[model samples]
Target: MSALAKQTITEQEFQGFAVTDFPASKRLKVVTLDEATIRAFNDAVSEWTVQGIEYKPFLRFEVADRLDAITNYTLGKFLNATVRDRATGAFLLNYQGSPNVEEGDARTEFEVKLSTAVSHIIGLSNHDAMYGQYYARFTVRNVDDSDSYLRKAHRRMELHNDGTYVNERTDYVLMQKLKEENMQGGDSLMLHLDDWAELDKFYKHPLAKKDIVWGAPKSKNVESKVEHPVFFEEDADGKPLMLYIDQFAEPSNKAEGKYLYEMGESLEADANFLSVPMPVGSMMVMHNHFWLHGRDKFVPHPDLCRELLRQRGHFTE
Candidate 1:
């Protein structure tokens, strides 16, 4: 439980959506859009296709504005506030009822646009080198030949922050479940820095501020190496903000290697993390620095397939 109170959002806070604490954690807000809001949003952006938004970056913001307008800007205001607040810096957005969109690639396109509106409402998404677009859409299957553990269905991807190896500042991460079939397990794991049991043990260590070399593999399409400590910087409230990933960190010496290994072990062992099961068409947006995220290993099936969309971006001042 966080030091902050579990917030209660009244209808006065917003007209089109309702905000409430996720059953498991007070640090996360679950925003459910009423069917009217969803239908209005769908109609508002029906004119803009995913390709058009991809080709015309300005159009994405326009689409965001349309949705924000339908809620009299309350939805955007609430989402922005949640992302900026240290105590509650994450939200899971889903429609209250089934979205009546067709089932197929068209549905995927609608989800892409919905996530686009969200990413822009808070901030802009960085161009994803892996997908060669603003957002990346990839599928996880029972058998994957990918270089990273991202697509592997058999192993848990360790909890860590994003943008560790990249030069960009990844302020937030937006993940939407586009589709899933014959799937089991693979719930998203989330842990806040304040909730970590051993945060102080690592933060007060001498190597907490020391630089560690970080690099991505060939599949990530990132060639250059970068350097940053695990607890890279402090938030405005003076809390630690991390930049770490188990697979990418290249510790130079024995001491650094041991530190990185122990850190991963601590995070994985920590029981405070939330195992969130994301329903289809639902999207989760979280502050990346203070919140660590990963995926649980999937139960194996011959035709298991889970499609996910990711957009990582820095906060706009």
Candidate 2:
């Protein structure tokens, strides 16, 4: 059994879901909810609409509790433990099979509600200014005119941490695929900080903790700039943690520029990263500080399109 498998409860331990190691990386746990669990969740939350959950904040927590109740609260405990552990801070959650819900919008609503429960189980998501909600849903296509690489297609988005330009602490990030058509490639890219070969060389450098300006593009809906070093803080065990991105970083001098550039170059060249193919209903959540996430480019097809939902926030406990 892999290390993550050891950390996870055995299939017999949890009634609603089964936990295992994702094939691409043992550090990532794969949690699959059985069809019965999905059906129970859908029936439990059927009374609450997505709009109702959005309008009322407390309803979000209620949805989370309903999902946990089905599993006898084992799902929440396992998810929290996985996220809190430095060695295994990420998981890919998908259900066993289709539920009884109709396809199209009904299925999409189920996806949204499911993601909301998962997020709340871990922590509350920060309000996404771009979408004016706690979560944001965006799409990518073959051709686009976007301010940033987020919506752009045909090129690999360099690996980087999220919420680098925002003031709030981003303890975790949740990404879910809502729709896809004629999509080839575009697998989710991930790299654990501990896996980076050059982590120490950069962490011990003088510029590692020096504050640097970070500003987002107009499309991000963030106007003000924030300042923080690549290695901004340390975990409970004193291991280095990071908050950085290649695009939003604005170094003031040659020294800062070179440091930022080398960091990005080193991360991009690292061989320890994992490339994960995300299924439509599956959601991937990771520790934002320790695991860098990105997207691989899609094949150029005029009809290509993919819709994704995202939630970034700090842990309450």
TM-score leader: 2
How does residue 234 of candidate 2 score in lDDT?
95
Candidate 1 lDDT over 1-317, as tens digits, reads 12232243233368888888999999899999998988888888888789999999999899888888989888887888788788888999998764567889777877888899889999989988899998998999999999889999999999988888899889999999999999999999999989999999999999999999999989899999999888888976788998899999998999999998999999999999999999999998999987999999999999999999999998774
What is the Å distance of residue 276 in model 1 from its true position?
Answer: 0.5
Lowest lDDT 10-residue stretch of candidate 1: 1-10
lDDT of 2 by residue, 45-70 (tens): 99988999999999999999999999
Candidate 2's error at 154, in angstroms?
Answer: 0.4
Superposed Cα RMSD, model 1:
2.7
Per-model TM-score versus the true fold: 0.95, 0.96
User: Judged by lDDT against the true structure, how good is candidate 2?
Assistant: 0.92
Candidate 1: residue 260 Cα off by (Å): 0.2
